[model samples]
Target: MSTPDTVTVDGPGLRDDPSRPGPVDVPALLAHSRETVGPALRAAVARLDVSSREQAEYHLGWVEADGSPGRGGGKAVRPALALLSAAAAGAPAETGLAGAVAVELVHNFSLVHDDLMDGDRERRHRPTVWARWGAASAILCGDGLLTLATEVLLEDRSPHAAAAARLVAVTTRELIRGQAEDVAFERRADVGVDECLTMAAGKTGSLLATSAAIGAVLAGAPTAAVRGLSDYGMAVGMAFQLVDDLLGIWGDPAVTGKPVLSDLRSRKKSLPVTFAVQRGGAAGRELAAWLAHTGEQTDAELRAAADLVERGGGREWAGAEARRRMVAAERALAGAGLAAGPHAELLALGHHLIDREF
Candidate 1:
């Protein structure tokens, strides 16, 4: 197997590191997000009745299937990014925590709905909300989280509240469009590179961009700085998707918590597979035929298709593209004129996106 390139050093464990300085405090970021955002989410659910509160808690992974507290919630990366970006932009990081909470809630909301749509059974190494609570309950829970996210955005008394609302509106719409495109691509054979990129940007990139933009807006950053941060977010978002696509094909199922070749088994029109189809000749046709087949294929057939994608340069192409985007993200961060310390951390984050093994 061809070895993939390494991107950046991994962050510390899930707890904050007081000894560490600069942007390397992923543990600290994660801890802060959990402490702050976690409470806000719980309070949001508290306003509802006991049954609804239980459902919301369960979906947040804060409570068990029986509505008891659980251990396997998310890493809260989106909110951390928002708060970090705000801090880097010169505002008190705490000021942006609510925005972080809002983004993370919306993200979890999307994940719950996405799991339902994709018929996914597991998330964060546990049974998905839909799998545990059934589809109807999951859908309602997702709706509730989304509603709470809007409330959080509006609750912020900052002047940027209006802009944050606009960001949320645009991000939500883009997410729906991206999800629609993804579903449509599954049944179609003619998906192109540009189309896939567009879908990825909408589905994945929009939220990240909004998160960064929210930070800048809350920090009272200049318009140019906000635009730069948005660009940085977009580039990182693209890299994130490319890396995810790579993991879907080449990742160890044990670590990924999913079946190996899961995307291939489902015939997902991921970037590598789509690029292979567009660039590979007869081999590509064979792969497409396999995808079009209604019956399940043997393990060997799946391996052959994966081999075709690798041999056709799809994997390499995607990897290279991810690197290119990481570079672009770095340039954008530099242009944003953040302090050297935070800027370095953001740059490391860009590299980390492309380099993550999990």
Candidate 2:
């Protein structure tokens, strides 16, 4: 997984500065999201069986393994995007509440399943749901979240309620396909750049696109706005994933909450890995040899692979690709016809997304 730097929104600027902290206060934003989306999320999972509900709550960062309060949730980006999209369309932020909560639930659902498939045991500095409560509980918790996503939307009773439910379901399918492709890529030595990009779009872009589009749908925004926001979300998602891919290879372990070269150690075919492999250069050959002979990579071997990825032009190419996608996302957002206030925040977020140290 890609983990970028800690991002704080300071007004129109997405960059972090201690002197003149702008409006993109990440903590404030998350607090706002929790205020808006928390109630629905809680009620949705309230009916689950004791163990499943406990796991779900634990995964959501509401409680710990022993039912104590825990600081364990994600960045809440999807929900923020949904609410921001609604505001951009001149609707009250409250108007997109259901959409925001639903997307968040779906996001967590994917995280649970992905962790299990990857055999990952840690996230956000805590044991993964599967690690703490067995894989069965994790699976059941993910299913509960998925079902609750639709259930919450169904409770909205607006004209767009059914539509929102349908959109999430479809996006979830796309997410699953993307994840399947990612796992498949791990088994193949011949992964290509184009295929990797497609997988990134599928795995990461689909749900973000839904997050952006659902707000417009719920607010009864024009069809054009929805399409534009969807494209914008996809572009942002692509950039976000590329940045994440970069961090996977070179990110600071302290900031990312994962070991250095974690992706290489796990033998995952990230964009850089795939790009280097497809380069067919000396470095690419060396990297391939290391990969092919892998049982458990020593730290030194992982470092060597990272060096080879850079030497093969993978690092430079991914950085360039990330910048390109950032530009594309901005253009897409411009076409979204959002109000000036919301547009500024979203644009700043786009900037913040690409420029972080975590």
Candidate 3:
């Protein structure tokens, strides 16, 4: 969602050299991800019945059995990170393809169940799997994907397979726990900023850490370097969630592909709103009154709530926090001592995440 920051680099830097080009093209990265992962996913889905498999493939934006292309695939950022990290760590990029695919499959599995639990009707501008096929079917499909992800990891015979397995298992549990905490926060009036950050780290950060760790492992990087990449991923992931919280309140529907004020309408305990509530002033009191009101909020009420969040300095605080995390991520990447180009790209990506408007 974020754009790249402009840097006045001397000679040889990404923006300075006319021949070196600018930031990585996200669409090209996505295309590479699809080329590497798509066939394997299709093969895994072949074990299912025609209807179930069709539905699963549709969710992935693959062709149905009838060979018609489906809709709504995502940007594949996780897999791209995995593959890029591998390359940055000195292995052939293709060496990490299996790990990339596995991580992405697990991510999609979680997303399917998450949409069901949240009763979200749409994803990637299309009806969610649960919305189209029913909760039972969606659950089964998600489970199947999870199983396949583990199988893919096993098939790769990674030297650090045990560690990768442990990471995924732990990440999955934390994901559930974070989601539960999020749901619980919706009913409570006193959600703390620290608690919200903890939930965000567990839910969004853990898997990203795993993605980078797995890539480093596959590349046979030293333990210290692997750990550094994991830490970098965690920091970047937190920054991403903070930016997402900002977008949930202020982003254009066209850019985010979601309705404006949707998080407010759902009464989500996002960082900005929670901070505003904790500030406890005129804005906080007005927000509390709105929360207690029996009726649903009109557009004006939602706008007022957003204004309260902004006035309370929640947005500013979150933006600063995201920037801080980006700095931490850059330090971690430097600690890993990876090649200059990929490190530059990763730093650019981190800046983009923190600075994005949508």
TM-score of each: 0.90, 0.91, 0.89
Off by over 4 Å in 3: 1-23, 48-51, 64-67, 352-354
Q: Residue 48, candidate 3: how far off, in angstroms?
A: 4.2
Per-residue error (Å), model 2, residue 4: 14
Model 1 TM: 0.90
Per-residue alpha-carbon lDDT of candidate 2 for residues 213-245, written as tens digits (9 for 90 to 100): 787788888887888888888988898888888
lDDT against true structure, model 3: 0.75
Residue-wise C-alpha lDDT for candidate 3, range 293-328, written one tens digit per residue: 655889898898889888877788888888788778
The best candidate in terms of lDDT = 2
What number of clashing residue pairs does each candidate have, in the order they appear?
3, 12, 1
In candidate 1, what residue range of length 10 has the lowest lDDT sum?
A: 1-10
Full ranking by lDDT: 2, 1, 3
Q: All candidates' lDDT scores?
A: 0.76, 0.81, 0.75
Model 1 stretches with alpha carbons more than 4 Å out: 1-23
